[model samples]
Target chain A: MMKILLLLISFPVFAQDFTGCGEYKFKGILKYDEKAPLKMSYLVREGTGSQMTFSLVNKSDVITLAPFIDKPSQFKAKIVKLMDGTKGELRTPMEIGLRFPDPMSASDTGIEKIKSVKCQ
Target chain B: MKATKPFVLPIFLLCLSFSVGHAAEGSKQFYFLGGGGEPEGETTIFDGEVKRVGSFINSSGWNSTVSFNGGHSKTEDLIKSKMGKAKNAGTFSEKNYNDLMNEIIQKLEKGELKSGDQLLISIDTHGAKRSAGKDAEKTHRVALAHSTATELNNLSGARTVDLDKLEKIINLAAEKNVKLGILDFSCYSGNLLNLHNDKVCLISASGPEQYSYATTAVSLGFFTFSYPITFGSKFFDNMKKGKSLEELFIDSRTTGDTPDFPMINTKEGLAINEMMYRFLTPYLNYNYSSTNNFSAGYVRRGDKFEEQVCRMESSHSDFLKLLKQMEEAAAVANESGREEFQNLREALEEYRKYQRGYEETLRQKFDVEKEIKDIFKKQFPNDQKAWEAYAPLDFLSLNLDSSITYYEGLAERDKGKKYFSGMWDSTVAQLKKQKEISEYVKANLSQNGLDKLKAQDEAFAKSGVTYKLSSRISAEAKKVYEALYNKNKSAESNPCRDFVL
Candidate 1:
C-alpha cells in the first residue's frame, strides 16, 4: 500500500489545502470523458482507477479515505474549491496529470510518480 | 438487469418485504461524499450535515467511503480541530467524484459486486437551478468543488457535476444489478428523482423548485435536524443502529415543520414540509411547535433517531420539551450575547449622533465669537469699548454652545459628563453580562450542544468586533470630554464677563 503525503498551503482568503506527490511507474494515458473539457487521463501501475487513481494523507494523520486508500492507490488526488477572489470562482474540470522530481522513492515520496508522461 | 435474475419486488413499490438483512454475503459499501464546493458552503456544512456522515466512517460493519469538499482540508478539519487527526479522508472534486463512480462501474463489470451488495452514496453540497436533459426529473445542479490545482483545467465559472453524466454511471450500476441508493442533501435535491429505478431508491433534501436551509444553532441543514420530526431524528444515527434509510426519511418528512421553512425560535424550533408530510412520510407521533413551519429540514439533529425509536411509542411527547429545554438554555445564552452586541451597537450609534451635534455646535460657537469680533472691529476700528461689549456677547454665545442639546436633555454637559464623566460606568454592560453568561454556559453546558456553542462563542471572541468597537467609542468619548473641559475652562474667564450687557 502506497501512502501519499499532502503538504498544505493556504489561499489568502480561504482555508489551506495541501498538495502531495508519490512515485508510480508512468503507465499509459486513457480517455475519461471524450466530451468534457479535460478528457485525457493517465494511470498509476498500483491504482485501480480506470483512467488514474491516487489517495491523500495530511500531515501525520490518514483520515476519510480509510477504506479505499489503505490499500494501493484507487482514488484521485481530490480537488477542492478554489475561489476567484475577484469574481466568485475558478474551476478545475476533472483531468488526470502527474509529475515528480528525480529520485522519488517509497520512503520520502511514495512510488515512481507517473511523471511528465504524455498521453498517446 | 444483470443476466441472472432474482424474485424481488422493485424498491420503490413499498420495498416489498424486508428482503435485505445481515444475511447478505456481500458487504454494504457506503460512501459519504461531499460538502459545499465553495468555502462558505463548506464551512456551513462541514460542521453539521457532513460530519454526521460517520454512519460507517469509523464503523467496521459497513465499508465507508469518506470525501469532503472543504474544511481545513478535504477531510473534515472540524474533527481535526477538536480531536486529533482522522482516518483515510479523501477529497471532493468533480473529477474525483466521476472517478469514484467509474470505479464502482468497473467493480460491477468485473463481477466484483455480489447480489446482496448494497451501495449507498450519500451526498451533501450546494445546489443551483439549471436546465437538464429531457428525461431529467428537474434542473437541480450540484455545485461540485473544483480542484485548487490551477494546473490543468482552469475554467472561469461555477463548478457543477453534470447530472446527466452522473445519472449514466448510476443507471449502469443498476443495469449491472447493483442496489444503488442515493441520499442527496442539497437544495432542490429531489431532482435526483431522475435516478429513480427498481435498483435505486433516492432521497433528497427538498423538491426541485424549493430551497434548503441550515441553522447556526444546529449546524445542519433543515432536512437532517428539521422541526417536523420529534426533536429531529438524525438519519445516520438511526442508520448506525439497524434502522433503514427509508424509515429515517419517513420519520423526518412526516414529522418535520414541512410545507414551509423552519422558523427558528431562540426558545422553540418553529415548523416543517407539507406536501412531503401527506405523501411518503406517513405519520410519526409528533405535533406543531408553531404556525407556517412545516416546509423545512436541518443538517443537524437534537436527538439521535435510535434513542427516539424506543421512545416513539412511550416517551415521544416529552422529546420536544426535553429538546426545548436544552435548546432554550443554549439559544438564550448565545442569543443574548448577540442581542446585546446589537443593542450596544445601536447605543454607540446614538452616542455618535450626539457627538456629531456637540462638535457642530462648538464649531458654530467659534464662528459666532469670530463674527462678533469682526462686527465690533468693523463698527469701531480700535474702539476698546466696543471690544469689551462684544466680549460679554461672546461669553453668552459660549454658554449657548455648552447648553446645545441634540437629544432633548441629553446635552454635552450632561452627555459628556454622563457616559465619559460618570453614569453608565460599564460601556456595553448588557453585552458584557451576556458574554460573561456565555462564558459560564460554554464552561458548564452538557456534552450534546457544548462543542458547537463553544465554537460559536470562540468565533465570536476571535472576531473581537464588539470589543474593538467599544474601545474605539471609549477613545472618541475621551476626545469629547477633553473638548468639553477646555470649553468650560474658557467660559470661566470670558475677558468681557465683568462688562455686564
Candidate 2:
C-alpha cells in the first residue's frame, strides 16, 4: 500500500508525454558503454509555422530539437556536449537514428526506442 | 551676309578685349544646389546651409547670387532677401537639376562674368560609381534630389552628372577665364580633384574609395556640418584675404572624432600664404547632441579586420619559413650547433601552435557562415534578394566575432606579449556600435510605415547603404581569404625546400 502511494506521487511529476518508456541507443562514430546503453524521453511542443519542437532530457545534457525545414518529424538539434558542439537531426522510426553534416566530427549517428511499461 | 560678317568680327574683337580687360577684378560667387533629402519628413539641411552661406556673403557686402535647384519656399525667401532669386523648384527632378547646371555653364560660357571672377559651386547629393566601358575606369555621378535608381538605369535620360560632363563644364568655364572653385559635399567627392588646373580649385568630403556618412540622428553630414563650425565667422573673411580653397578645406575640421580622413588636393605651384580673417571664433550652430559615426566606424573595422587576418597568415608563413631555414643550416653545421638546433625546434613547436590557430580560424569562418545563412533563411524564407542584401553584413558580424575569438586565444597563448588583442578589442567595439546604429535604422524604417520588404528595398535604394556593404566589405573579405590561400599554397609547394639535408 505504501509502495502504491509512492508510485502515484512520482507518476504526476513525469514530464508531459515523458512516460519513462523510451530507450535511446548510441550508434555511428560516437562510442558508448554496451552494458548500460542510453535512455531518454521527449515531449513535443508547438513551434513556428510547419515546425514542431521536441525537448530531450538526459543526465548530462538537455537538448532541444526542432525541424530546420518542412520535415517536422525529423527534428534537428545542436549537440554542444562534444568537441565544441555540432548541429544534426534525428529520424525516429521503429528505432530512431541520428544524422549530421558537420565536417569536424562523424560521431552523430544514433537510434532510439520506447519500451512498453507493465504495472500490477 | 558680307556686311554681317564684318560686323560679327568687330563685335567678337571688342568682346575679346572686354573679357581680357576684367581679368584683374575681384572674385564673384554663385551658388548651385542639386539634391537634398525629402523636405517634409526632415529639416532641409542643404537649403539651410545655402541660406547661411548666402547670409554670410551678404553680410560681408559681396556681390553674389544663389540658385538652388530645390528649396523650401521659406529658404528661397531667405536667399532672395540676402542675395537674389534662387533657381527654386518644388521638386528637383533630373531634368530640372541638369537644366540648373546648364544655366550656370551657359552663363560662364557667355562671359556673364569677367575673367578671374571665381565661381564657388557647391553640390550636396549622394554620389555613386557609374561603371564604364571595358577600357575605361568607373566614374562617379551624383544623384539629384528627386532622382531614383530607376532613372539611373535609363542612361539616355539619366539625371546624375558624370565626371566627364563636369570636366567639360569646368573646361568651358576656364576657357571663358572664370576661376572654378568646387565644394562637393558627397561620398567619393574627392574624385572632383581630377579637374584641378591652374584655373580651378577643388575640395571634397572624402577620398574616392571612402564613404561620407550621414545620420538621421544629426540630420546632416558630419563633414557638411563641420564646414561652418570650423571656419567660424572667418568663412567669408578668409576668402576675402585670398586664402585658397585648400586652406579653407583644411581649416574646416571634421566634428566628433571622425575616422574619415578628409583630403585636399591642390594644383602644383598654387599660392600658399597664410592670411588671417577678421573673425576667429567658431560656433557649431546646429549642434546635435548625438552624432552618426557609422560609416567611418564601419570602414575602420573592415580595414582592421583585413589587416589582422593578413598579418596572422603572413606571420605564420614567415615563422615556418624561418624554421625550415634553421633546419637547413643546422644540417651543415658541426656538433657545436646542437644547442641552437634544440632552440630552433622549440621555436618551431611554438609557431605550429599559431599555425593551428589560423587553421582553426578558417574552420570557424565556415561554421559561422553556415549558421548565419540558416538564420537568415529562417527569418526571410520567401525573399532571396533580401538574403543577398543582408548576407554581407551578417558575414561581417561573424567574421569579426571569429577574429576576436582568435585574438583572445592568441593573447592567452602568448602570455604578456599580446600582439593584436588591442586592435581586435577596438574593432569589436566599433562593430558593436555599428550594429546598434544598423538596428536603429532598421527600427526607424519599420516605424516609418514601410513593410519589411518595402523597407529593405527603399533603404538600399535611397540611403547608398547597398554599396556600403555588398561591394566594399565583400571585396575586403575576398582579399584576406585570398591572402590566406596564397600563403597556404606557397607553404605547401615548397615544404622544407630550404632544408638542405
Which candidate gets the maximum lDDT versus the true structure? Answer: 2
RMSDs, each prediction? 31.0, 27.1
What tens digits encode model 1's per-residue C-alpha lDDT throughout B1-501?
A: 565344434553345344443343465677666654454333443344444445335543566666666434423555443222233345667767787778767777776775546777766666544342233324355656552322111112345564555576567666775666676655555566655554555666554443443322232345433121211224443445445544455334423222212111101111122212222111211112211011111101123323433343233234224334533554665533233223323435543343333333333433443444454455435543212322222122122221222112322334555433222122123223323432443344345333433443353233323323333333332232222222223323211111110
Question: Which is the leading candidate under TM-score?
Answer: 2
Candidate 1 regions off by >4 Å? A1-120, B1-24, B40-42, B71-75, B79-89, B132-139, B146-157, B217-233, B258-501
TM-score of 1: 0.35
lDDT of 1 by residue, A1-120 (tens): 121111111111111111222223221222222232222232232221111222221311121111111122222232332212211111111111222211101111122233232221
lDDT of 2 by residue, B1-501 (tens): 446665898899999998986564555655655443332322343444454566556554444444453435644455566445333433455665566567677777677755756676666555543232343223356644432323111111224555445676677766876667666655555566666654555666544433443322122345323133222212332443334554455444222122222334342111110110001000000111211122111111222455655665565456446544644664665323334434433533443443344334433433443444554465546643323333332323233344335434544544554433443344344444434433443444323223433433343234333223223322222222222222223322110111110
Counting clashing residue pairs in each candidate, in order, gives: 55, 1
- Report how far residue A114 has shifted in candidate 2, in Å: 54
Q: Model 2, residue B317: displacement in angstroms? A: 16
Q: Chain B TM per candidate, please?
A: 0.41, 0.45
For model 2, give the RMSD to the true fold.
27.1
Docking class of 2: incorrect
Report, to 2 decimal places, the DockQ of model 2. Answer: 0.01
Error of 2 at A111 (Å): 47
